[model samples]
Structure formats: C-alpha cells, structure tokens
Target chain A: MSMYVDMILGGVFHAAVVFLVAAGLQLVFGVQKIVNLACGSFYALGAYFGITAVAGAAAMGLPSVVVLPVLLAAGLAIGLIGLPVERLLRTVYRRDESHQLLLTFGLLLVFQDVMRFLWGPTPLTLDNAYLAYGTAEFAGVRVPTYNLLVIAASIAIAAGLGLFLQRTRTGRIIRATAENREMSEGLGVNSNRVFAAVFTVGCMLGTVGGALVVPASAASLEMSVELVVEAFAVVVIGGLGSMRGAMAGALIVGLIRAVAIMVLPEAEILSIYVVVIAVLILRPAGLFGKAMA
Target chain B: MNLNRRSVLRGIGAAGLSASMPGVFAPAIAQSKPVRIGILAPRSGAMGTVGECGIRAVQWAADRMNKDGGIAGRPVELVFEEETSPKDTIERFRRLVLQEKVDCVQGLISTGVSMGVAPVAEEEQALLIMWDGTTQDGVKEAMPDARYVFRSTDNECEAVMSSLLSVKYFGNKIKRVAGINPDYSYGRNNWEAFRQILTRAGVQYEVVAEQWPKVGTMDLTSHIAALKAAKPDFIFSSMLFADLPVFMKQGSAAGLFEGVNLALPAAGWQLNQLKKSFMPENIVFGHNTLYFALPDASPLQKAFVEDYMERYQQAPHWEADRAYFALAAYKAGTEAAAKATGRWPKLDEIIDAIPRQEVQSLGGPGRFRADKIAEQVFYQGLSTNDNAYDFPTLRTVNAYTADQLQKPPGMDFWEWLKTAKLPV
Candidate 1:
C-alpha cells in the first residue's frame, strides 16, 4: 500500500513539471493563435534564473522567510522580458505561422547558445532548498518534501487558473478574445492587450514550473530541449489550447511512465510515446479538447 | 607553448619545403618529419565536457615530451578534431588521416565511435589509440580483427570483477542484489558481467529489482521506491554522466541507497566532487579502468596526478588519465620500435610495438596484450567528499590488490571465476 502511495506520489511529482509548462503553451495558443516554439527557452531561463536568484538571496544573508517570495519575484521579472519578445513576435502575428515558428526556433537556438556561452556545459546545482525540509514519512515510506510541494503547487496553479478563466472579468475577456478576436474588439474588449496579457501569464506559469523543478533536479543544458518535446506531447494529447486537457494529459503520461518504471523499466519512455500515438489515432481532438467543427 | 592545428601544419609545411630546397635549409631537412598524431574528440556536444579533457592531455603530453626531446628526436605533432557519433568520427577521421596524413589517431570516450573508427584506421593503416573506450565489445567482439586499434581502460568484464571487494566486505549481507543501469548496451554489459561474477562466487544471490531506464532519462522516482521496497542488500549501478546527479539526489531522498551497499561501476569516481553532507555513504567506488589513486598504487600514478594539478590547477578527470596512458604506451612502444628499426617506426611496426609488454600507467603498470587492448588491474575504493582533497576523494577504502581483483592466467574470465578461490 505504501509502495502504491509512493508510486502515485511519484507520478504526481513528475506530472507537475510537465503540466505547468504545457498549460502556458496551451493558454498562449488560445489567445495568440500561434504556437511559440521558443517557449522552451523561457523554461530554461526560469531554471537558470531560479538557481541564480535563490543563491543570491541566500548569499545576502536574507531571512529564510524571504526565500519563496524572492523566487516568485525572480520568476515574475522573467515574464516581463516576454513583452519585448512578444513585440518581436507581433510582427509574425498577422504573417504566416511558419514565420513565427521559424523566428521562435531561431530564438531557441540563440537562447541556448547564449546560455551555454555564459554558464558553459557544466551542470548548475542549487539543491539547497530541496534539501532544506528533508524527507517526510508517510505510512513508513519516505517521501521527499520538495516533491510534495511540487505536487501541491501544480494543483494550486491549475485550480487557480481554472477559477480565473471562469470567474474573473479579465479572464472572460481573454477567453472571448480567443473565441473571436474581431468580435471581442467590436465589443470593445481591447484584443491586443488581451494577447499580451495572456502570453505574459502563460510565460510566468512556464517559468515557475522550471524554477520549481530545478531545486530537486540540477539545472542542465539538456533539460529545456527534453521538456519542450514532452510539453508538446502533453499539450497535443490533452487538446490544444485547453487547460483541462493539459492537466489530464500530464497525469496520464506521468502515471503510465511511473507504472512502466516499476513493471517493465525499459518501456518507461516508450510507454509515454505509445499512448500519445494511440490517443492521436483515436481522438485527434485530445482528451479535453473540442473538435474544430 | 601550445600549438594549434594551423600552426603545426604550417611548421610541417615549412619542414617539407625546406627538405626540397638544398643548401640554405639543409640542417632543417636533416631533421626527420614530425610524428603527427590526430585526436578525435567531442568539443561541442553533450560529451564535450570530458572530451575536451582528453584533448588537453594530448597537448600536455606532446608539449612535455617535445621539450624533453621527443621520440627519437622526431618532434611529435598533435592535431585535434571535434567528433561526436560514429558517422562524425569516420568523416573527421578521414580528414585527419587521409588529407592531413597523420601517423596516428586518438579518439573520444565513446565505445560506439571506437567500434566504427577501428576498421577505418586499420584499412588506412593508421595507428588508432582510443583514449576512453570501456565497452568490452570493442576488443572482444566488435573489432577483434583490427590490429591497429588499442585502448587502456578496463572493459566491462574487469570492471565487474573489481566489485568482488564489496561482496567480501559485506559478507552475508549481499544475499539479495539489485541492478540499476541505463537500458543500453554499456549498462546491459555491466549487469551481465556482475550477475555472472556473483553466480560464480557461490553466493545464493537473488536479484530483487532490475531497473533499466532509457538513456537520457531524468526521473527515477518510482524506480527508487520500487528498489527501496525490494529491500535489497546491494545495488549495482551503471548510470553515468549528467544522469548521475539526478539519480543521486532523488535516490538519496527516497532513502534508496541508505544503509545498503551500493556500487556505481561507471561514474563512482565522480562521487568525490559531490558534497559529503548530502552524499550516500558506503557507495563502493569500484576501480574504473584507471582511477587516479590506488592503495599501494604505482609511483608513475603519483607523478601523473601531480603533473595534471600543476598544469591545470585541478585534479584530472579519469578520462585525462586514460588519455595520458594512451600516450605513455605510444611513447614506450614507439621508442622501442624506433630503436629496433633504426628509423621512425612504420604503422605496422607501431601496432606490433608493445604486444605482451607491460609499461607504467596513470593507475599502475598496464599490459598491451595481443588483442591490442591494454589490460590493467582493478582496485576498489569508498566514496567520500571530505577526504584528503577539496573535492570528493577516496580514503583507500579496501586493501585488495590487482591479483585479487583480476582474472588470473591459464583460464577464461568466466572459467577462472567458476573454479578459482577469491582472495579476501
């Protein structure tokens, strides 16, 4: 029973990182009508910024009370850089998506090389926060406290985003803009502002996801490239532009991977790809996604 | 001073030109052509971090040897190529040897690349020294016919045999064993050899869990929990490179490695760089093909480590030692062959230089056998960060020697394992 609990917890922890990154990509596609290929760079940036910020905060002899808030502040500041990135992206909004994709793909390479130039190829370690709380026992099985926080934080973000979309005026306006941009503008919703605001929030969520995972897993050059592929898979399997799809798809992939590690071990990665292919064949609209018609 | 690729070529070109021009440059013409060595290493990819170390070792050995009067007064010239995969290796190797006309070639730490490059070098008749190819298939099955290919690192068989120290130390505790390795040829080979060793040791060992995650796998959460549930007394791991820290961090957090004896055959030497405060104790840092330190280790090993520190301001990675060992074998073989032939040794002569001969190495004295792979002995050590150095260092955890860890003569490795009594 404890082993099962541990496996489920492991699945949740694994899913948390993927869902958070994919949800933003889904949300941005809803408002902007464009898939940002460079979203992976934002995720990598978050990890790099997170470790640097966390270390800087600790080095300043700041109280531990400021740690969580400081990490949040660093994450929010990173989203602001997306404004200029979006402005560069604005040029391709009216143009073909291939242009936006090519431009963003170029940005991804540039960001990767720039980070490599600064940090070199060595992996960065800032596992201090991850080690701070130590392990918590649940029914005789040891659970990493950092993993629990990641699980809870992902749930909180998902629930909060769902509520914001359903209950808040700004979110409703954004949703209306997503459905019909010109009609929302005709209804005086200010469509451009919605696009900018949606893209920013999505970027923040993606960045936070990366920031949270870096404390446990060391920040690596390969992390962004791998996450980008998984994020696309999760979003594609869930439903493009659907937050619920992102959540559902992440859990399914995560659980399958977790189970595979226990049962076959060799099929851990292969299992995830198999489900995505099966889902695409059966339901192209994804689990929570609505059909185009 | 360091010589880049262009300058070394320019010097060679000048020497070649001077040889033709008679009177003015006749003294330079009398000097034999530089014995050029081509180095194929990854400088831009994922393995570049360690690959560059091999390149640096080549240059360091070249400079030091050249200053000390190079082999038979023929100045050694080293050329470096950034190579990644087997295809990349073949392409860069062609350019290095066919176009540049290098006398010899040294390659990356990957076994796959070495397997591909072996036949190419043999067909071209260029001596190929692999700095770090630890895969058993390279010598045993992959390129057995290729006489020119050589390596100094311990292959999969010797690596597993070295873990016998851990078994003897733990005694009855090793009744149940688990293996956590990457689901690839390298890791599979490690497990097969380890399992065979345990079976032959006459131990009633039952494999509790066998976890083989795909290459570049990041998460090992459920894998850890499952292993912890198995409650195995020992876990043999072949996980390495960037995947290590993630395993160490998450595996340690789940208390997977706590109180249980662990063996990281591939990347155990890297444990010294990790912090002692967070690291798992009792990790059997099994002697890799060439670890820097050994109990009653060779004097040449001490000189090599000190030389690396003096030059690079840090302790050398084990890959650097392998690179240095390749150079040492080349130096010994080339000098011996040159003395016998009374000129620069030919490609075939270099291949036949030190067969069945032993020479000094980074870890100790290693033998260049008939198969062309330099067979070195193994010794076990413990993982610790707070030892004698700033980074993680071993404290000579065990008292076992090469004879105890190695497969003795007059029998096959498996045959000897089945019959021979292990020395404790």
Candidate 2:
C-alpha cells in the first residue's frame, strides 16, 4: 500500500512539473490556433537561467530557499523576452498555422544551439538542494522534498491562473478574443494585445516548468527537444487549449510513465509514445477537449 | 568586353607561365604532404563532451608529433568528423577513406558506433584505432581478421575481472554480491563476466537481487530500495555517467550504502568528480586506470599530467589519457614502419609494428597485445584522503599485468570459460 502511495506521489510530482510547461502550450494553442514548438526552448532556457542563478547563490553561501525566487524571476524574465516574439508572431496570425509552427521550430533550433554554446555538451546536476534539505518521508516512503515543493508550487500557479481567467475582465476579454477572433475585433477588442498577452503567459508557464524541474533533473541541451515533445504530447492528449484537459493529460502521462518504470522497465522508453497513441485512438479530441465540429 | 583575341591569348600565356613556376604547386605538395588521420566521434549529442575531449587529445598528440619533425619527416595531419548517431559513423568512415583519403582513423566513444565502422575499416584496408568502447564478443566477432581494427580501451572482460579482484581484497568480509547495471549488451556482458569470475574464484555469492534499470533512468529510489532489501555484502554496478551519480545519490539518501560495500566496475571517471560534491565513502571501486594524477616517478607521465592540467584545467581521466597514449603509439608504430619500409606502411605492417614497438604513455610503456588490443596494465585503488592535493585521490593497492588479464587467442569459448579465474 505504501509502495502504491509513493508511486502516486511520484506520479503527481512528475505531472505537476509537466503541467507547468504544458499549460502554457495549451493556452497558446487555444487562443492562437498555432502550435508553438518553441515552448520547449523557453522551458530549457528558464531552467538554464535558474541553474545559473542557484549556482551563483550557492557560490555566495546563500540558503537553498533562494532557488525558489530565482526560479520565479527566471520564469518572468523568459516571459518578458517572449513578449517581443509574441508581437512579431502577430504578423503571421492570419498566415497558415504551419507557417507559425515552422517559425517556432526554427526558434527551437536557435535556442538549443545557444544553450549548447553556453552550457557545453555535458549534463549538469543540481543535487545541491536534494543533498542539503534531504529526503522527506511520506507514508513510509522517502520522497525528495524538492519534488513536493514543485507539486505545491504547480498547484498554486494553476489555481491562480484559473481564478484570474474566470474573475478578471481582461482575462475574459482574452477568452472572448480566443473564442472568435473576428467577432472580438468586430466588438472593438484589441486582438493583437490578447495574442501577445496569451503568448507571453504561455512562455511564462514553460519557463516556470523548466525552473522547477532543475532541482530534480539537470539542464541538458537535449532538454529542449525532450521537454517540448512531452509537453506537446500532454497538450494534445489533454485537448489543445483546454486547461482541465492539460491537467488530466499530464497526470495520465506521468502515472503511465511511473508505472511503466515499475512494471515494464524495458518498455519504459516507449511508454509515453504508447500512452499518447492509445489516448488519441480512444478520444480523438482528448479527454476534456471539445470536438471541432 | 571588347578586348581582342591576341590580348586574351597573352593573358592566358602569362597565367600558364606563373603556373609553371618552380615551387608553385608540385614542390609545395612534395614538401608538406602529411599523413592524414581521421577522428570520428559524436560532437553534438549526449556523449559530445567526452567525444570532444578525446578529439582534443588526439589533436594534441598530432601537433606534438609534427613539432618534433613529424613521423619520418612527413607531418601528421589530424582530421575530425563529428557523428551525431551510429547511423552516421559508416557514412562518415567511407567519406574519410574514399574522399578525404586519411591514412588512419581513430577515436570512437560508442561500442555500437565502433562495431558499425569496423567492417568498413577492414574493407578499406585502413587502420582504425579505437580509443573507447570495448565489448568482448563485438571486438572479436566483428573484427576477427584483426588486421585493421585495434582496441586501446580495456575490454569488458578485463574490467569485470578487475572488479572481481576487489572482492578478494574484501575476502570473506564480502559474502554475497548483487548486480545493478543498465539493461544493454554492455551491462549484460559485464554482469556475465563478474559472475564467471566469482564462480571461478570459489567464492559463494547468492543471487540476492538484481536490477537492470533502463538506460538513462533518472530516478533510482525503487531500485535502491530493492537493492537495500536484499542487503548483499557488496553491489556490482555497470551504470555510467548520469545514471551512476543518480543511483549513488539516491542510494546514499536511502541509507543503502551504510551497511553494504559497493563495487562498481565502470565508476572511474565521473564518480571521482562526484566525490567532491557527494563525498562518497566506504566504497571499493575498479577503473581501467587508477591514480591518474600521480606521475609514478616517470618524466613522461609527469610531463603529460602537467601539460594536461595546464590545457584542460582539470586532471586527465583514464579515457583522455588512454586516448593520448593510443595516438602516441600510432605515431611510434608509423615511425618504426616507415623507417623499415621507407614508405607509409599498409594495415598489416602497422599492426605488426605495434607489438614490437613501445611508446611512453602517461601510465607507463604501452605496446600491442597478441589479441590486437593494447597491452596495458590495470590497477585497483582505494579512495583515500589526500592532504596535498585539492581533491581526494586513489591510492594504489594492486596492479594486474596485461598477460594475466588477457585471454590467449585460438581458445574456444568452453576452454576460455574453464581457464577463466579471478586473480587474487
């Protein structure tokens, strides 16, 4: 029973990390009708920034708690950088969706090579936080405390975003714009502003995801492609642009991955792809996604 | 546009006269056509860092040779080809041989990549000096002719045998052993080697538990728990790089290492770096090369260590050092062969020259084995406190000779299995 609890907790933590990045992808695809493949690049950059900040703080003999604020700050910084790109993307809003994807794919390559130029080609570990705070026992199972913190932070962000989207006028206006871009423009809505805002928010989510996972995993050059693929898989499985779907999809993917690691270690590598394919076959639009027709 | 034909002919005659000058093209080619050596390894993937380091060492050796008047006055030119995956290795090898026409090829980090390019090297009749990645069957089965392919890295059999020797160091203290390795050919081969060596050593070992974690497993909590529950005297791990440190960190946090002795065969390079961060204790590990920082009272070792430290800003790992030595041996072999034949020797002549030739390595003198592998020695050391150095260093306890560790050629599998025994 405890083993099952540990696995569930592990699954939840892993889901939360994926959710932080995939939520933004959901929002961008929901509003813009374009697939931003570069969300993974932002996640990787955010993680790299957080690692450098945490490493710098540690070198100056700062406490491990500094990593949290560093992560948030790095996420926001990446979010701000995404603002200009989001503006540029507005020009291609009327273009074909594939054009946006190709542009973002090019950005992904650029960011990946830029990361390699900065961090070299080896994996860097952030075991310092894990080593210092140590493991926390939950239900007789040892879990890294940083992982729990990641879950808590992810929940807070999700709730905050949900409240903002539901309760705020600007948030509703952005949603109104996403519902029908031409209608929102007809009703005197600044569609360009909405697009830029949503894109920035999406990038922020990805950056936060990257920053959060750094304490658990290292920031590698490969993370851009790996994280983006997983994020896209989560977003697609959750329903493109559906927050509830993204959450459910992340949990399913994370649980499946963890369970696969336990039950089928050899097949663990293909577990994610298998899950995505199965989910797609069962529900073409995803669990919580609305049908296009 | 309106120039006359006579003026155009005069211009062409002038260009031809310049082309016919004494030292224009022919003498320039004759004076400085160096032996081109091609290096193929991944430079932009997961294993790029180590691959880049190996290439750097190869280039360093090539530069050093050219500075010392080259091999028989023909300079050695080093060409590096980056391969992103195993699929690219064969294509790149062919390009190097047929197009670039390199005299020799060297440096591969992946066993799959080495095996992929081995047949091409044989078919092309070019010498391939493999600096890393050794599989007992892959090396022998793929390159049975053994005329062109030579491995400098210790084979998996020798690595496992070295780890088994450490079991005897613990003696009856280590009663049982568990194995944790990546679930691949390398992992399975290492586990088999360790089991065979243990059985031949006459030491009783229970199959308490084994965990063949998927390659690149980031989380090791469950595997650590499984190993802890078994409570073997020691654990033999074939995990390398990121997986190695992840397992060690989780194992330490879970208190798995508190009661158990850990024996890792491939824990040489990165674990040493992780020691400063993790402070690993009470573990007896085996590496192909140990005490790499110590000069062993040899000028060659001292010079190489000092130069490496100055260049890389860190101590040279066994991988880096072995590659340096392999390149040095290649130079030495070429020099000897060229002197005897008065021309660039063929693959067979180079292989023959390697065994008869010796070169000063960072570890000591390295020659060729009858099995066509590097006749290198192995050492087992304990990680002890170093009051003088910045980091903890390995103190040598045992040194195994190449002859004792190597299996003789022409021995069948059954005969080799019967003769295989752990040296204590």
lDDT per residue (tens digit) for residues B1-424 in model 1: 1121122322222233332333222233225567677877765444655676666666666666665555556666777776667886788888888888887787667877777777787788777888776325622455545577785444564455445755665656788898888777778767877787776666778999999876556677878877877888898887776566677778878887777887776564343335554566656665454566555656766766678777766566656666766877787787777767766667677778866457666666666667675566555566666566544456555543344554443335556555656664
> C-alpha displacement of B3 in model 1, angstroms?
17
Interface RMSD of each: 3.7, 6.1
Docking class of 1: acceptable
Error of model 2, residue B135, in angstroms: 7.3
Q: Pick out the ten consecutive residues of candidate 1 chain B with the lowest summed lDDT.
A: B1-10
Residue-by-residue lDDT tens digits, candidate 2, B198-229: 66767677767677886555556556655655
Deviation from native of the Cα of residue B85 in model 1, angstroms: 2.4
TM-score of chain A considered alone, across all candidate predictions: 0.95, 0.94
TM-score for candidate 1: 0.88
